[model samples]
Target: MAHDILISGIRRWARLPVAGRIAIVYLLARLITTGLLLLAAHASTPQSRFGLSPSMGQLVLGWDAQWYWWVAENGYPSQLPLTESGEVAENSWAFMPVYAFLAKGAGLGEWGAGALLVSLVAGFFGCLVLHRLLRDRIGSSAAMWAVTFFACGPLAALFQVGYAEALFVLLLLIALDLVLRRRYAPLYLVLPVMGFTRPGILAFALFLGLHGILRWMRRRAEPLPARHIVHIVALGAFATVIGFAWQAIAAVVTGNPSAYLSTELAWRRNWLTDPSAQFVPFEGFVRGAEFWMGQAGLPSWSGWLLLIVLVAGAAALLLRSPHVRRLGPEIRLWSASYLLYLLAVFFPQSSTLRLLLPLTPLWGALAVPRSRLYRWGMLGLCLLAQWIWILCMYGLAQTFWQVP
Candidate 1:
């Protein structure tokens, strides 16, 4: 009887629309994963990292979640806290304000755990919006595969966590969809919110700029309308200025004009001996690779070589994919610019894979294979990778520097 009911539910789920199926599958997977994690948390020693939350649901609120919760519960410190030597300590200024702001107003009894609920709900809708965006380009079948691949990604656990990736991705896709549809009016509303949420808005803005240039070139024979002129100028300004709003707020609140930048640099400074040193791009990844490789008795440069190979492989696969080729200029530019932003500004750090969540459209490219065997094989591998990531990076990550 129980087996029949479960099979019946699976049939019903399969009969639903692509978006509905995506949502149901994603939420149900999250439910089972969360329950199992909670059970494991309860079974462990209370003092361990994995045991940080026996409540299971709160397990998603791990490291960065604490920083966001700080902003939500206490707000930014009027006076930035400093170390004994006058250096800036890690604080809420490093985190953007959108998730914190929403979590604060959620009215959940505990503001910190409320963030997890916010993330889960946002993730569900984000998946649906992602499916919708892909469906317009690929047909419904390919789009469904894209969403499935996204939901079961190795880093997909981050979506269930209290991170702002879900919210940021949802806003970005909505804004991108509006642009694709030539709906500029609603973008004004989302662009500002996106700017407030994450620095990825700059990439989105660049994508929009590229889209505009291509459109103008195609329509060069036609005279530019007053409305197009307004939209082009307005959107460009919105993207450029809004990305820096949080930095301005941080500067003003902390009373140090460079508070935001300094705080960001300070994270790098933590591992460096020189307090006055500047952050060098790829330095962290190189250094991290050296340390881990040395432990395995490998040459220090092997780490650097490995990173180069991995990046090159990913790029080759991305560019060669038929699904990626089907993407419009806007998405292609957005993906490229966003990856550059990650490389140049964000730096190759521990959370780099998790940061790639905003490039949700890449999953569509990965899903382009028409073979059922290939799709199912990739899905199975992704699920296995998720389990491994959870165990090594989250569950038994007590003594390691596991950044999710």
Candidate 2:
């Protein structure tokens, strides 16, 4: 009788409205993550960044969150700070203003509280939108499973932190959904917010260009209207403008033409043997590959070979994998575009896992497998990975490599 009652309860839960189901899942995931965080906090030592027995607030507001708070407390500096060597130092210009200012506007009495509230709300909504985005392509069951994987994945810490990723991802999922539906006008509004929310809008802009070309090639079959062509072209141009607008704004304020680029390069300097290397598109990854390989006691040539294999393997998977192909063209295109963007600009480091958050939509492809064992095993792995990530990044943040 007890077994039957439990089964009936689960059946009722499964019958709830999609939003209700998502809310329940999201809440549970947050609870689990919170528990893991608490565990990490208890285990934290004076050696850790958070110190011994730190609170949830401290853990959330540590690392880059401190920068966001600095931005909120004091706006970007009119004059850039410099090192003893006269190179630009990392400053508020490295972070975008949207998340910081929005947290301030939340008026939650404390910056950490406000930032946490924003991340929590945005993360829940992001899951809902993710479900909606994936459900149409894959069935509701698979979509829900994908959301579960996303909520409980390795970077689940993002949902509870003061970072802009949750909000940026919420906006990105909405934008991607709008694009897949061919609703172009809404994107004009979405693009600006997304651009300000994070650094990934350039990837989205590139995806738009590729999407336009793909539509044009299939125009005979799908009948591309002239108005859509115009919308696509205009929206792509608008996104490109927004992508660079921040740099221009930084330049005007600081009275230095390369203010933003120099500020970004400041962070890259930490890992480079030649601190004065210029920003070259696609060179970061190549250098990062060699750097990390050397740190791991491997040959430099092996790093180059590994990078080639990884890039080629990723291309092959996107082009030929049955599971990924089931996700349809828009998702596959976005994934490819984002990966390319990362290779072009980002220097891989401990934060690379966090940077890959934009590819969350591909979780749907992993959910395409229907075996109960496969699904449950993957969930177990995700939870384990999440705990490991929290412990390394928060509990024992003793080295630069442990950064989240």
Candidate 3:
């Protein structure tokens, strides 16, 4: 009788709208994640951070979350903290202030709990915005599939954590949605706040510039409106300027103009080249690939070859697939720009997949036209992988390699 009721309830939920179904699935995933966290906490030492009556807030406030919380409660140090070697320690400058600052402003007694709440709410609405953007291109069912795949994928567990991804994604989606609708004035307002969230503003600006250029070329014979061109240029310039806002603020505060960039690039210096003293995109990935190859007992050449081949194959598929081709130019360009930003700037670390959450829209292309067996199999693997991520990333108390 209980099994029958469970099946009936699921069938009823499946009949809901795309956003509704996604919300239901997301809540279930959260429940499972929280249960796992509690069990792990029970098994941990009494003095461990996760031990005893672990709640959502306590479990999710790990790694970078702590950094954000620190910035929220104590504020950035007047001078950047440095290691014995005169390099900056993992300080607050590396994290953006949007989410943390908002939490601080709310005067939440426990910043971590506030951060977790912000992430949860932002993640849910982010999905709805994504779905709304997708509905016009693909049908509602396909859009629902995209949201489901994203919210339940292997890395979906990160959405529940007190990370910046949920907020970041929400802002970007809002900006993109506005741009697509030709709502320039509102977009101008969102650009600065969006830029304050992360360096993704750079990718977004590139998308706008490239998109505008293509439009100009197509209408070269006809005289385009000067006001339209001005708006386009203004949008691009706004995003570019805002992208540097935090770094400029940090430089002023530290009285060291190079403080922000120097601290950020320091992490890459260890692997790429010490004393390099600048940000070079893709350098981190190259260094990381070499290090990982050595750990896997594989030749460096083999690793490079494999990475190149895989990237090439994925590009080819995206270009050739009819589903991908059907996507609007703005969506295509944004995905391309964001992927390049990742390859160039982001280190291929344990947190890499979590970083790729912004690429959620692209998953819509693959979600459509798949067999039930294939879809279910992929979801099962993703769910199983989530547990492994929790175990290796958070459950263990030792010197875990992955930062999550």
Candidate 1 regions exceeding 4 Å error are 1-15, 39-47, 220-226, 275-318
TM-score of each: 0.86, 0.98, 0.87
Could you tell me which 10 consecutive residues in candidate 2 have the lowest summed lDDT?
269-278
Candidate 3 Cα lDDT to native: 0.74
Model 1, position 167, has a per-residue lDDT of: 85
Which one wins on lDDT?
2
Per candidate, the number of residue pairs that clash is 0, 0, 1
| Per-residue lDDT of candidate 3, residues 1-404 (tens digit) | 99999999979877787766778877886777776666655655544445544555676787788888887778777798888887776678888888787755553676766777777787788878887877788777677777777667666666767778888888888887887776777887787877776568888888889878866886776455777788889889888888777878999899988788778776655445453566676876776777778778988887688678867876776677788765566778788888877887776767776777787777678666667887677667777877777765666644435557
Alpha-carbon lDDT, every model: 0.74, 0.93, 0.74
lDDT rank order = 2, 3, 1
- The 10-residue segment with the lowest total lDDT in model 1: 270-279
* Pick by TM-score: 1 or 2, better one: 2
- Candidate no. 2 TM-score: 0.98
Error at 34, model 3, angstroms: 2.3
135-243, model 1: which lDDT tens digit per residue?
8787777888888877777777767677888888889888878877777889889998888776787777677677778778867665656787679678977897887
Candidate 2 Cα lDDT to native: 0.93
